[model samples]
Target chain A: MKVHLFIPCLVDQFTPQVGIACLKLLRATGHEVVIPTNQTCCGQPAFNSGFREEAREVAYHFKTIFHDAKIIVGPSGSCISMLKNHYRELGLIFPESVQVFEIVDFLSQYGQSLRFHSSPQRIGIHDACHALRELKLYDQPRELLKRIPGLDLVELNDGQACCGFGGTFSVKMAELSQDMAREKVKTIQAADVDTVVSLDGGCLMNIQSTAEGMGVTLHAKHVVEVLADAMISTGEQA
Target chain B: MEFTPRSIKANFTESLKDFTLRKNLTKATHHTIEKRDALKAAAPDWNKWRDAAAASRRESLLHLDRYLAQFENQFTALGGEVVHATTIEDARSKILDIIKAENGRTVVKAKSMVTEELELATFLNAQDIETWETDLGEFIIQLAGEHPSHITAPAIHKNRQQIAQLLHEKMGVPYTEDPELLTGYARQFLRQKYLDADVGISGGNFIIAETGQVILVENEANIRLSTVLPRIHIAVTGVEKVVPSQQDYANLMRLLPASATGQKMAGYVSALTPGVSGGPERMIVILLDAGRRQMLASEKWEMLACIRCGACLNVCPIFNRGGGHAYGSVYPGPMGSILTPGLSEPGNAPDHAFASSLCGACVDICPVKIPLTKLLLQTRGDVVNTHHKSWDNLAERSVWKSWSLMMRHPGIFRIMRWFGARIPVRFHWGSDARKLPRLAKETFLQQVRDGRFD
Candidate 1:
């Protein structure tokens, strides 16, 4: 299968490692991975902030870019959801068969083929709100991590609660957003884990930044990066 | 402390800093949520019940005018009076006229958000008709000269000690923090008003149009006393509360208590028909249409299906931290944010819709499946389209315009990322709490060009 990689803007500019990890992991699963170099974003920031025209304009661009792909997968849950759920929501004329999936949801299918043998570490999971509610990819990501040899997954209490990095909401209600982040980090800490893995890079960014600001020694990593690092492989992209 | 929805940003700043308020809100909301979740987990058909309720609620909304007329006819045929009020002022004056005509002197009230919308107590007291809030939470807030913080739990922001102090100081009762003793004090005082009062005023959880019965649900039993013990009863409810039939109302009833307070059933559920033996002979239902018809005509009419469950508020992360007071409206939290802007004109609570992070927890927990987060985002667009004078928005619009253009062109996006990463920048907003992510030294586009993934 050919997997058209959709790297969200945040991952591309800031966390290219996540995008590369996704490319490596998709390759590990015996698939051809192609990075659509023009793919900038799924227009979540503008759409969420009430700029419909901008969101629509960017969304049409997205549709034009990836509408023909067999399967498009992204490293971030929120970004993938924007492509899946938001086109119709914005009243934009979108095709029904864009076929987009979050990395975990896509990779979970090739479980037997892909191998992860990460060193032993107990980690908590902060599933993104969009992935949990919109895409309904709740246990799929946890299931992927579970098969990793020696990777102990502890689900945090109040795991359903949002991390409050609502794109522009983080900037508009910065203090409140950070407060929510701090609270979530503490919950992850309560599970007695220093490292927390999440499905969305946006959430991990908020969690990581907020934890650092609070002077808390909590490491936040995306699930793709964690799994990609565990297996030795020739990282190749078509 | 005095604030309006327009001042929400300012209001939440104070609310967020108040440790005591945060503590009270967290304890109350969490306890309700836990109880509600427990009740839901035990029910095998909770989702099925929700679907039925949503269908019924939508059925009524689709035929709002027809059902409202049917409701008026059925109630009037049974000797109940029906009055229509298009605005808040109109509703207030009509209530005054009814009291004046009946020579009613005092009012004993139950918990009603509509009455809070009408500011009934303030108006009636100014008219020299003694008005008392009989619901314990309502009574506490009334005594404190404050508004109801939460829709169902009016005094949810107050701790027991603060409530005890309010009772001791305002009601001339002895100070005590004991919950039962506090209830007893409220009960003892309210019992007399129900007997002596000439009229009772309450809000309906639902009105069965086919049966012409006004339904009231409460844990305090104050509604029972308020509706039955007075000579005249006035149920001030929104026009949207009417369901087409008893069957529809019953489906909604199953979810209300569970969603509102996590109870299997309220302590009292009064189905008041005009001619019930112990009930008031002169029954008047003030069906309020304060901007609902406009909502029905608009794209946001799905919001009218809200059952005032407060489940959305309990689950909202913003409401969890900021508390309901920050909304600065009679209706607070997720549902309130949508309703406040949709039900009213722009500039009233312009920021309410924007305050949300668009986390779909409220959407998930809403009994009627209102799609609150979607509506919140849509309502944000409404706010932007309607209220455009914010100089901040003028600047924001251009930023997003540039961002969209940058997204359309990969070359521009790459250059922007190049600058964005090396800038070592702090955003003017939220910088106090957040730090920018360090950009990848070699962009992923560059990484691919360099054969890093080869």
Candidate 2:
């Protein structure tokens, strides 16, 4: 299988490890991966902020850039949702040849034969709203996480609620966004896992930053990063 | 009093500072969610029922003018008066004229959101016609001289302690924190107003066009009293409230109670057509347009499908945090955010549309399937287009423009990628509470090019 990696702008800039982990996971499942260099942002920021015309130019470019790929996979649920669902609003359509997959969905479907060496004894899943509600990828990631040997999957309270990192909404409604993130962190604290794992880079970044700012001792990481660490094999646990 | 300066950001910031109010709102909203969830889960056919209700509303709204006319004709034929009010002011004046025509000195009011929209009680009081609110929650807020904080629970923002305190301060009731005691006091106090009042003003929950009947549901018997105890009954409701037939009304009733108060049925459900033997001799129904027609004109007209159930508010995170007063309008929460902007003057409640996170929870929870988040997004687009460009809005627009430009050009993206976190400032609210993750040292594109994944 041939897969084109559409690393979201946020994942490319702020969480490259999640992107790399996605790559490793794809390769470990015996798929040929191609990194598309011409790919830029998904135009969701412009699209969500009521700049549809502006969003269209970038979306049009994105479609052209990833036009030849048989399969497109990304580490971000939101960006994938934008390409698959929201691009319709811009009067643009993806080529029927290109099938887009968010990373967890890709892994669960393709990584059946892959084995993992667990590093984290306990992990908590932070359900990103877009992944949970939009993509319906809620259980797929959790099921993938359970595949890692000796890893415990702890459920955070109110885990399905939004972290309020709604692209521009976090800044536009900063106070409310911060309050919501604080509540989420408190819920994570109650779960008492070593790290809170999520599939969306936007939410993970927001939670990581909010936890740091508030002096709360909480580690937030992307789900694929944890999977990559767990799949380092028996001898790689130095 | 005006709710605020019409800026949701400013209002939300101020509301955030009030810990007790946030806690109270959270408590109330969560309580409703628990009850609603249990009842909803118990019904295996809840979604089917919701579909039926939404379908009924959609059909009614598509032919709203025809349904309203049918209602008027049927009602008039049944010996009832139907007054068409094109605006809030018109509705108020028509109700006032009815009261004056009856030579009414006292008005017993039930829970009516349309009357709230009309500000009828305040207007009548100014005219020296005493208006007594018979709903206990309404009665408490009326005594305190405060606007309703919620549509269904008028005084939801106030707990029993605060109500007891307010009642003690205003009505000379014995100070007690027990809800039962407070309710009893309010009932005892309002029992006389029920008999003495010559006019009863109630809000219609549903208007059946085929039967000329007004359907109302309430846990308290106050609405029933308001319908029967007074000699003259004036039911004020929006034009969008009418349905085609009694069967449609019955289908919608299945969802209304479950969605509103999580009951199999409300404590009382009353349907009145007119010319009842011992009921009010003169019954008038005021059908208010009040920006509803304008809302119905747009592609977003499906919003008028609302049944005033307050279900959307209970599940709305923004509403839970800011409370109803933070919205500063007659309607509040997800539905209010759409309604206030749709009905009011342009630039009115400008920031209310952006108050949501686009979570789509309200859309799922809405019994009529209003697509609240989509309407909210459309409203945001309207606001952004029509907004008086403050420097902030201009700057924000410019930022989005730059972002789109960079996103379209990979060369520019590569150039900006070099400057990294400092170039964009990432999260704009850095000085406030939230902090954003620092940009990566080398982007994934660079890493992949350098064989990092190999």
Candidate 3:
């Protein structure tokens, strides 16, 4: 089967490796991957900021690029959420046949087929706010993560707590936003794990940035990065 | 008492600095979340209850005038009078007029956010009526010379030690950190005020349109006493508390107490039609509008569905960090972030709408399913597009304009992404706490074009 990947603007530019890891994971699972090069953003920033016209313009641009693809997957739930839900809120019609999924939600269905290799690792899951609450994505990623051998999964102290990178909110309410990020970092430092993984770029960026300031050693990874690293190729297992 | 002439942001920044406040807030909020979650885990029909409650609320709002009129007629037939207040000042004056006409000198008050909004106690005190807050939490905050920092748990920002100290300093009672002892002191003090007062004031939780009944729930039992002890009674509530029927109230009963205090039922769930025997002789219900009609007309009509459980604050990361006082309104946290602005005047609390990170924990736990995050986003849109254009950062809006321009055309974004991260200041709040990431050596699409991951 073929999967058309929509790499959100943030994942495409700032953390291209996450996009790459997602590609590797899917291809390894015996699926063909197509990267839509013309796609820029899912228009989350403007929609979140209440700039409807700007958000709509970018949203149309996005829809035009992904209009033909039957299945669209993205690494960031916040962006994919904007595509899945917010477009209708903008008074636009999302094509009925076009199905969109956040990568982990997609992976939960397909990830069971992927094989695991032996490796020693311990990591924490960020469970980003939008992914956790908006998508109601509780079991899919964790169930997938559990399939990997020799990988110990640790969850955040308060997994539902936000990392405080609310697009322009981090800048607008800068103090409380950072205070929230700092509190989130302190929770990580107090835990047994140093690595935090999530399917969200905003959280990964904010948490990592806040950790850097507090002199904490933290490794931020996309969930696919951890999964793709541990999973063996199907042919090799055969 | 002064509220410090500080803006909401400044208040939050100050609260964030106080280690004691932060510690108290964390402990208090976490305790509530844990209790609420445990109850939620046990209730298998929880989502169904939420749906039912939401439907009930929507039913009420959809035909609010009809329900409200039915409530007034039924209440009146039960020998109760309903007065509609057009504004906060109007509500306060109307309550005072009722008290003054009866030669009422002292008042015993229940914990009501509407009374707090009306500044009822302050106005009554100025008129020489000694009023006291009967709820344990409200009493603590009243002694502290402050308004409620939280709606449900008025003194949630304070720990037992702070309360012990406040009681000791204000009442000259010996300080004791014991929770039971503190309650005893407050109970002993408020008992006299309850008996000696000429009028009792309480807040209504729900008004049943079908039977002309007022339903108020509380763990403390103060609401019950606040209604019955005094000769004259006054109940202040918003216009939005109407429920279509007793059945709707019964279904909503499953959600309110469970969400508010994590119990199957509050210690007392008082259902009484005003002017009934054993209650006050003269009963007056003040239906305070204060922009609720405006809300009903706007997209934010759903916010009226809030039961004021304060569950949203308990789960909110923003509320955990800044506490409720920072919102600088009678209401705080997620629901307050909208109500403070969206109600009364849309521009009243200019900073509130954008205060959240749009986290949906509030929506997830809301008994009525108010769609808080979406309303907040709509409120934000209102702030930028309708109410206050100057409130949003000009630089940030322009960045969105530029970024959106780039995004609409991939060719422009292709070149822009290279220099976007280098813009340094970016969209303003790029302080050390919030930093932008550097551009990667290769874009993901570029890598794809390079035949990577083949």
TM-score of chain B of each: 0.96, 0.96, 0.94
Clashes of each: 0, 0, 0
DockQ score of the complex predicted as candidate 3: 0.72
DockQ top scorer: 1
All candidates' lDDT scores?
0.86, 0.85, 0.84
**Stretches > 4 Å off in candidate 3:** A234-238, B1-6, B387-394, B420-429, B451-454
lDDT of 1 by residue, A1-238 (tens): 8889888878877788888888878878889988777777788889999889899999889877876687889988788888788878877654555577898998887645776555698989987898899889888988888877898899999987889798999888887887788899889888999999888888988998888877888888898887887765644222
Evaluate model 3: give its lDDT: 0.84
Ranking according to DockQ, highest score first: 1, 3, 2
Off by over 4 Å in 1: A232-238, B1-6, B424-433
Per-residue lDDT of model 2, residues B84-144, tens digit only: 9998888888888889988999999999898889888889999999998888888887888
Which 10 consecutive positions of candidate 3 chain B have the poorest summed lDDT?
Answer: B426-435
lDDT of 3 by residue, B343-404 (tens): 75545566787788987888888889888988988887776665435534466578778988
